[model samples]
Target: MKDSNFLKENNARHMWHPMAHPADSLANPPKIVVGGDGVSIRDIDGKEVLDAVGGLWNVNLGFSCEPIKQAIAAQLDALPYYSTFRGTSNDQVIELSWMLREFFEPDGLTRAFFTSGGSDSVETALRLARQYHKVRGESGRTKYLSLKKGYHGTHFGGASVNGNANFRTQYEPLLPGCFHIPAPYTYRNPFNETDPEKLAQLCATALEDEIAFQGAGTIAAFIMEPVLGAGGVIPPHASFMPMVREICDRNGILLIADEVITAFGRTGDWSGSRHWGVKPDMMSTAKAITNGYFPFGAVMLNDKIADVFEQDTSGRGAIGHGYTYSGHPVGAAAAIACLKETQRLDVAANAGARGAELFAGLNGLAEKHDLIGDVRGGHGLMCALELVSDRAAKTPIDKATIGKIYEATYEAGVMVRVSGPNIIMSPPLILTVEDVQKIVDALDAGFSAA
Candidate 1:
């Protein structure tokens, strides 16, 4: 193997990482992951750590998913690359579309529009939402609404609707007519409401108020992650999504479920919307679609939206948006293998079981460590630990303190994610009881060091 120092130096000098300052990479060199097996990753320094983050919450089947690997190789051998754009389509994409229709049947999504990844999927859904309105002669419906602290991707349209300032401050002058409502985040909310049910009702009311203020006739769609991911795994109350769905229906607005992190058995259900017994008008899915083996995603459309596009005779239904690799055969093959294995193993049950264990462990850690201000989880495998300097004041821990805890956690043999003052974990759904314990042990050690 090459010298670890040499590799680190080169990586620091040559690469700029996403969601990080380029200069900071040199000061705190990132761990160079060399290889992965099952739920563990080996860094260039030759230390193996339990990957509690699941490769950015996408590697649902873990690193050693052989069937998916084989499928990709086989697809490459047969047909390396092919586009599913206008005037052309591939057999792999056609087969995958049928499979997706059946898979997302409960969500009422009957058609799949392929994209390159989650961001592309969000862009497609947003554009299609507007076009759907145009097809029905409601061109005035051009506005969007979302929950504050919700993350949708980084595209112009997605970023415009995104509620987090961290992702939008620098890219100002984004698309207009995008607004936000308060999320049902019980930890820190403007309502000062601690009860989950009350919080859900308040947030839903806020959504209704926003629509009234903005005029429902001018709104195109309401997009949100059923369980907010990158904004810190904030899962809403059981009543939240269903209420939002009813509100959108009454307002003549479409609902887009951004299931990038909570789809395909991640939330102990096929889709997060199903977890709450709500079917969205459109669903943006990616991340685990191909088990993170390939860059692929799909924006699913329900029958109502499909009918509008299908029955349009005004030439407005012709899609003017698509990526060159929208439906690459290789990605489709990988997705097929992933879907089969996901259903065969029934990872959702395991996710629920292991998630309970993980959540309990995190709650235990919170009791032991005063730094842990809040522990959030219970929906499925996704969880987060928000750190604070003072429990009463809820003062956020500084970056230096978070860095110390992160390094200690890495040294203790578990790799989690640091998002602001939150330690997020989205371990592979295939995790065993032993794996869950190891992650807790690592975090315990990290808290001790901090």
Candidate 2:
């Protein structure tokens, strides 16, 4: 291997990372991951740590999934590239589509549209939602509503509907007709209600109010994450999604479930919509679809929406949107192998079991650490710890303090994500009980150092 310092210098000089300032890279060099095995990753400096972030909440099966790797290699050798744009389609995508139909049947989704990644999936769903309305003669329904703090993706459509200002302020004058409502976040909410069920009701009512204000006929869809992932793993109350579904049904607004992070057994269910027993009109899925092995995604359409396009005699249904690498054969093959392995291993059961332990461990840590203001996680492998300088006032911890905790956690042999004041954990579903314990121990040490 090349010298770690040399690699770091080159990376600092030449590479610009996502979600970071270019100048910050040179000041604080990012860890250069040399290799990964199972749920652990090794840096170029030879420090191995348990990966609690799970490759940005996608790698459910861990790093060394050989079946998917072999499938990609085989497909590359056979048919490396193909576009499913018009008449031409690859056999692998067709097979994967069939599998997706079977998998998403519980969520009432029957048709699949291929994309290159999560942003593509969200954008596809957003466009298709509007198109569905237009095909049904509801051309005025072009507006969108989403929850505050709910993250869809970075695309224009997704960003317009996204609730976070940090992502939107820099890119001004995004698409109009997009609005946001209060999220049912228990730790902090506009309603100031601590009860999850009551907050869900309040948020649902807010959604209803927003729909009424926007006019039912003018609204295209209500897009949201089942359990808010990037906005800090804020799982809504049990009654939340079902209430939204009822409201959307009454308003003639399509429900778009952004399951990019919560799909493929991340939330201890096949899909987050199914977890709440709420069937959305369209579902945006990616990330875990290929276990982070390939950049691929799919937007699933319910029968009602699919039938509209299928029966439309006009060319309006003809898709004008698609990526050059959409339905790439290698990605499709990797997804196929990933789906097979995901089911064979039954990672959902393990996620649920391990998630319980992790949640409990985090809560225990909260008891010991004054900096931990709130602990959130129970559904699956995803969890978060909100740090506070003053627990009584819920004042967010300073960046310098957060950096200290993060460095300590890294030194203690675990790699968790720090999103603002939140310490996020989404370890591979293949994690054992001992692995969970090790993560807890590492966090314990980190909190002690802080």
Candidate 3:
């Protein structure tokens, strides 16, 4: 079985790759990553590469964290599988919920609904939003508002609400009534405004105007990523998030902060809401929650929604949504340990300090490289380098050029993600300033190749 072609043949015969054409996947045979320790991943060929994107931007504590592994193992030994359905709950689940509530601080959030991953978490949020509206006798409030270029998850509902066309092109005729408006992206400002605060106001005004045109009564919720992770890592415009909160309140609409990517210190804060001073009515979180140690996601509900269940409108009307893996004991244990390790290690602060260094490095690169059209990402550990065809015109580099740069970067031994012509970076929070310099150096080399 040591043959180089053995696993490739076996995989081609049996396994189907996600998000790829069959012919292309076979031709580019997937690199089998054998192991991960700290911020480094070892491929089957035994070559070591740094995990710049934290293994899909979920491994907040980096790879091979012993405490998380130990916690999962101990939970497996004690009670590997259990459900949080009906009235039954496990210690890990209960403790994790309380810990989350405490961490979030004196918010009105009263319950935590668990799911398998980010997509399911979005599904859960959509269902719960519908239920909450129904309980309040506002059943017609079925429409949702999300941001253009925003990515929630890949589920039917999530994808429908998400505004990225590339992800939803194949699945046309998605769920109806999901509308989109421009998010607070300063880099590609539609209004061409220089002031970040002014740009945010303009965007927020657009949202309010859209709500009015759509009739706020028909809209149940407005969802957005506080940091806009997938849409080229666009952080909110200055003081823009708080304005959204005000708009939602004025219109009696639920603000759902899809922190699935921004939660658990990705933004150098407990939640992106805290970073932006936006208190969302409902918050969906996952990814870094367990540091990718186990599959888990959660939606925290506010007291206003919780009150509906207390009135006893039906037979056991307790939110009335769940998944088979909801509140899995092992997942809960992993979350508990992961959260503990995050706090003990001060991961948020690490992200904050490291983010400053990363931003400076990228900014310097932007100044040096004409192909680098723009760079963005605030006080969080998120950054994106937009490649361009012309420096003075700020024109985006062509698709073919972007692909060439991406391939060149990969060949240069750095794994960076390409979203359109933008090379996005959300490296592991544990990265030191020196590690960030290395990533910048790799990007520089990739640029030179272009």
Summarize candidate 2's per-residue lDDT along 270-365 as a digit string, tens digits.
Answer: 888899999999999999999999999999998999899999998788878889989999999999999999999999989989999999999999
RMSD to true structure for each model, in Å: 0.9, 0.9, 1.9
What digit string (tens of lDDT, one per residue) describes model 1 on residues 1-450? 678777876987887999999899888878899999999999887899999999999999999999999999999999999777778988899999999999999889999999999999999999999999999999999999999999999999999989899999999999999999999999999999999999999999999999999999999999999999888889999999999999999999999999989999988898999999999999999999999999999999999999988998889989899999999999999999999999999999999999999999999999999999999999889999999999999999999999999999999999999999999999999999999999999999999998
Name the weakest run of 10 consecutive residues (lDDT summed) in model 1: 1-10
For model 1, name the residue pairs that clash.
none
**In terms of lDDT, which candidate is strongest?**
1
Error of 3 at 102 (Å): 1.2
Off by over 4 Å in 2: 1-3
Residue pairs with colliding backbones in model 3 are none
Q: Across residues 1-450, which tens digit of lDDT does each residue of candidate 3 receive?
A: 466567757655567876666886677677777778888787777777777778888998889899999999999999989878987889999999998887765445667888999999898888888778877888899999999989989988999999899879899889999999877777686788867888888889999999999999999999998888888888876588889889999998998989899888888887888887767888898888899989998898887877786775664456667898999999999998999898899888899998888888889988887999888876678988888888778798997777777767666666777777788888888988778888888777778778
